[model samples]
Target: MSIPKYNEIMPNILRYLNTNGEQKFRDLEQPLAIEFGLSDAEIIQEYDSGNGTVFLDRISWALSYLTNSGLTERPRRGVYKNTELAQAFLDKPTEEIQIFVKQQMALRTAKQKAEKAEEGQLDESSDLLMENNQTPQEMLNTAHESIRQSTYDQIIDTVLSKTATEFEGLVVKLMERMGYGGQVKNAGTVTQASNDGGIDGIIREDVLGLGKIHIQAKRYAKSNTVGREEVQKFVGALAVAQSNKGVFITTSSYSAGATAYAESLNGTTNLVLINGEQLAKYMYDYSLGMQTKQHIEIKEMDSDFWDGMQNDSKVG
Candidate 1:
């Protein structure tokens, strides 16, 4: 079965804590997965970002919503229990519990909006007031992904507008930023355009230049596909350089034959291919050709601090 939504998980969390008494936050995952009849694979399903499991994220937001609604309380760090208010809805329908949580969330949003307005920081079109089924973290993740995709498109367009020599230089800089040369001066360099046979750039693996990585950068349109013949030529160039490590980066995709050829040489030669999307992702990840516009910090309660306070109280 598919994993349950955050709102759907809310009522079950109340029921689980009511029956199980105060339980560790980690202990709720398996029982809740069982309650929803989720399969083993579903339990381990990760978000697109691969930062966390979907089930765990939803369960955490569900518990947070219940706590905010005053239906549940955390008596100690990492432990949760239902409150007297939760007992009233223990026997209610799932829809009823969902409605209560939604209403509570709406009221909280309204209060935040008012506070922001008083501070002259109101954003009417913000997702803060959007009525959606997604949990808070899901919404943030979606927004972040949308921004990243847009940035990737811009990066491709900007790179396509630059000269061929400039494109070669950009890839070399990207390799350096990715720590290819380990802080060595002039570790990555674009070859003189006329002198370069097929290799556009080269990166030293260390200060002594004991190891080298050859790079082939192609500035092609999105519709252009790098075929097997192009990949074969790059491989021949690598052979001429007597280097087993090579990276072929393009602002276009590779053909099926090209991909197969690269894979077939896995044991003998290490050939890495980077297509347009992946190239942009690497640039963004390494902060190449990208500037930070803003930073948003997501903070959570420090469970250790609270646990220490409880321990001190017990000792006194």
Candidate 2:
């Protein structure tokens, strides 16, 4: 899952405060990260997209918004104590969280405008928030998707960097498990004699078929990162093989410049790169020429699935 930015997170913050009355916001800082599903990756997700962590920035914004409208209070700079106004909201039902956030934002905006008029200057906070309130839902949705994809890409990159030999193995197995097996060749050392210089092996697109997908399996190590020079070399290899695409795997990292170079060079060829960790995961997934007894059971909703449904529902 992608990370939620402050704007995406504010609504949830208000809900948690409204429902979990066991303590005030001041006492709840440490728990909000888990409560809101924020993690290292999510934090990166937010940061990459100019958002705040769920615990610190988003929660603070929610509190400030509530307090600005008299729904919460702060006894000190970092301490938030709920007020009678907030307590009164407890009985209003969960749906009220939205109303509370919206009202506070509007109220805060009005107050900021008034202050701006008196001071002969616009409040930057107010301006920062003004756009937050007016942003279209579609824009928010797109931003969320972008953040999620960015985070996923980062995850993929990290997995690639950390799992060199493993990730390449996974893609190889994934290709096979996905039905490229037997048809896909392996480099005795992961490449042909020259392996076309870029081609690691070739997978026959179909069994008993002449069509093939040329591959490049690189077990990239941290100290040995993939670079534009490697990409260019791979491109040259592709020409040698008379194929347009190849897979490059790394267990270390890619400079940003390397990625851009790969994406832009020779639009005709599709270059796929998998770092190390991803390879291991793929191997584990395909069980291709690999074995493991570790088992996972996915419960199903088939007939007789509700055998205990009535009793369980009643107990709840």
Best by lDDT: 1
The whole-model C-alpha lDDT of candidate 1 against the native structure comes to 0.89
Cα RMSD for predicted model 1: 3.7
Weakest lDDT window of 10 consecutive positions for candidate 1: 307-316
lDDT of 1 at 119: 95
Assess candidate 1 and give its TM-score to the true structure: 0.83
TM-score of 2: 0.41
Q: State the lDDT of candidate 1 residue by residue for 156-275, as single tens digits.
A: 999999999999999999999998888789999899988898999999988888899999999999999999999999999999999999999999999999999999996688999999
In order, what is each prediction's RMSD in angstroms?
A: 3.7, 16.5
For model 2, the stretches where C-alpha displacement exceeds 4 angstroms are 1-174, 181-196, 207-209, 289-293, 296-316
Put down candidate 2 lDDT per residue, 82-198, tens digits, no spaces: 567666665565446556667667777788799888989866554445354333322444566575455445545655554545544455556767665454454122343432454
Give the Cα lDDT of each candidate.
0.89, 0.57
